[model samples]
Target: MKVKLTIKLLISMIIVYYITMTVYVVLNLVIYNSNITFGEKVFSVSFNISKFMEPYIEDLEKGNDFSLDDNNINKLTQNNIWIQVLDKENKEVYEVNKPENIPNSYLTAELIEFIQDPWGSSAPTTISTNNIAKGNENYTLLIGFPIDKIFRFKMTLTDESFKYHISIIIFSLILMTIVAYIFSRNLVKPMVSVVEDIDDLKNGIYINKKNKQGIFKEVSKNINNLSLILKENELQRKEADKAKEEWIANISHDLKTPLSSIKGYAELLKGDQYEINIEEAKRYGTAILDNSNYIQELVNDLSLVYKLKNKVLPIKFKEENLINLLQESIIDLLNNSKYSNKEINFNYYDDNIILDCDKKYLKRAINNFIINSLEHNSKDTIVIVSVLKKENNINIIIEDNGYGIKEEDFKNIFTRYYRGVNTSSAYNGSGLGMAIAKEVIDCHDGVINIESEVGLGTKIIIVLKN
Candidate 1:
């Protein structure tokens, strides 16, 4: 029924109390019975004394010299004994040292009369009489004693005994409760550890590396191993996603080259102004070469992406002069087929801007942005590249006069396979360039962000620690 610890302890204590009380009552009954038996023994001795004293009375009537020993009488009455004796007139003739504090009363009168009367039909077995005939007359010698002293002794013993018994019960209960509390905590300790581990798992924190040992130790170890398995699965999923993006990019580039080559050669075959001559053949040949170069470039870029994902690429990070690196990157972009003819605007503040990074990946990231801007924009639109040095970081902003991204789609532009609204129908590149750039920058502990408006131009901002 899911009882709480405190409640269970209380119930146990109550049961102990009742059991203790029952034992106490039984003990009192045994003690009282013993006192009753002792009372009967004392009464029997008094009866025998009365019988022995009757013979002395008979000798007194015969004028025999009686040497009564007072010491013997004193011993007989010293049991807190109250003896009553009566003569022929039904009068109290002898009353042994009864307490005066009791005050002479009708109880004495009733006791004397009852004694003087013949040991009647209503004789108590606990009291007795002897008839002593001296010469001729009949005299009833009645003797009786009050057992109240014995009763008082019993009461005193019972009161003291009851107090000690009750104390023992109380002390036992208190001690038991303390012992029970310690025992319960020990029993629940392992469960508490398990609960804490489960809470950590729920919060996505690492489990304890220590090997578990307890009643539930096996379960705990199993859960810990399961967490490791789940983490490995998550890592594998990310790797698969990166590989899928690389495959799509390679396939797009491959298809675009053949398609471009076919279109270009077919156009040259149909001469525009010149006649079908050797010049047309050379033009067609050049178009075929351009397509083949495009295919080669696509294959190389795809291979590089694969190496980056697989950690097979030898990315050596060294302190590089930022000015020279950016300058070479711009030259390469200008010499590229897609960006060479575009109107490019460059802004740079010449300084000893140094960075610790792989120069190849950095260049690829910048090249992708430059070529993307030139190819996606309308004919002859200007692409601006600017590098700004801040106090603790460097900011590189690449702005293009092409249509910017929509507000709803801005956040996901760097995601692999995401094609923004501004993408032209003739765009030949895969949608992984920005995603790859973002990943590279992340590995360098840097950030890349994009700010754009629907109709205005888009700006890509890269920030790296100085």
Candidate 2:
């Protein structure tokens, strides 16, 4: 990965460098070929002046008095150039197209000043100087151009200085390349690790939580959080699957027991070898009916739970007296011979606590809670059901002094098909009672909370909007 990233970065840098150098070279070519009369190109013209005046110098050496031909003179005039030749006495020996302010003679110091600041003269001009030698005689030639026509910029460099600057440039580029590599490595390393982490997540491997640094810190944190969520979801899925298996097994057993009884009773009645009395036959028939009723109840509970979970159950809401509903539910439970021995009490301050609810389902939900308390405890255990009005809401409280729910079962108390650890083996319930109760309360936009201890018993509070 590092090698590939390094190669990619190097390629990118090379591309950038190539483009920059290409632009620089193209710009230089354009400037060199253009007809601009300033900068270094114009400075090159000053060097060419020596060659332009070479023929005149030869003529002067041959005693031609520095005379110019028509072609050469035309060239000088078209370029706006003036020429002056001076002898050892600093007197002008030959001149052409000289300006009106030009002096015929010059002092050495004045000539030096003019050379230093060519534009400082009254009739300013850019000047170029050349020396001419003919045997023992010597002369100075001055070529002058119009002021501002040529820009004079002087730069000097020795071999050592040039090499030093080149070395510095090379070193700077190397250092920058190293820095870029390090920076990219820092960025890419984390990116690669994150990719690997995602791949692991895809394979169902969760990452351990840890602190991360650099720009990818947030990304790492989010990935870790996702892993934790996914891990938790996986655990929940497993638990649900295990619960489903157990529920199916329990249902099979519960159904088989009643079905076997039903089959045995019907077979016994149909057997011709057995002389059954009318009372015995009636008892057998009743037993079969009871088992069938139990199976029907289990199937109905399962169906209702499914409807509630899928939000397919329709509820018809109407105004009902909450206290009267509780009283009726308690009375109905007491009427049942099974729960007639259970010591249950009902208490309420208000006789008319009104609420919007589905009467049948709401009563079923309340009865499930009361029955749960009765079935899970001793017959003598005191079960108290109370209704209270608090402001604009109604609270129904069910308290029981019985074998309370275990701590481990609290989390899954309202979960469908989740039987508690302390549930009796003889109590062959569908395990949807509490879950249905909670769902029904939720359907009414109410909240139900349970508090329980190992021995002190359990308290369930149902709060509803008035």
lDDT, each prediction: 0.65, 0.83
Model 1 lDDT tens row, 1-466: 1236445655676687689989999877776554344455454323345444554455434543222346545744665443334446545444555445322333555654544442331432123456655445545444344433221111444788999989998899789777776665655566566666777778776654565686777977877887787667766667557756765776766676687776868776775865668886887887787777766766676676677678687777999887778789888877877566777777988667888988988887887777667666677568888889999998888998777777655766666655555655466566667777777787678888887776678898999998
Q: After superposition, how far is residue 66 of candidate 1 from its true place, in Å?
A: 41
Clashes of each: 0, 0
The alpha-carbon deviation from the true structure for residue 120 of candidate 2, after best TM-score superposition, in angstroms, is 11
Off by over 4 Å in 2: 1-174
| TM-score of every candidate | 0.45, 0.70
Candidate 2: worst-modelled 10 consecutive residues by lDDT:
38-47
Q: What is candidate 2's lDDT per residue for 1-466, written digit by digit as tens?
A: 6568766876687678779999999877775565445554334423455555687666666653567777767767777888888888888988889988989889988886776688777767878888877668799988788766664656688999999999999999889788777876777788778888888899999877674788889988999999999999999999888888899998999999999999999999999999999999999999999999999999899999999999998999999988788888999999987778778898888787788899999999999998888777766789999888888888899999988987668888887888775653377888899999999999999999899997889999999987
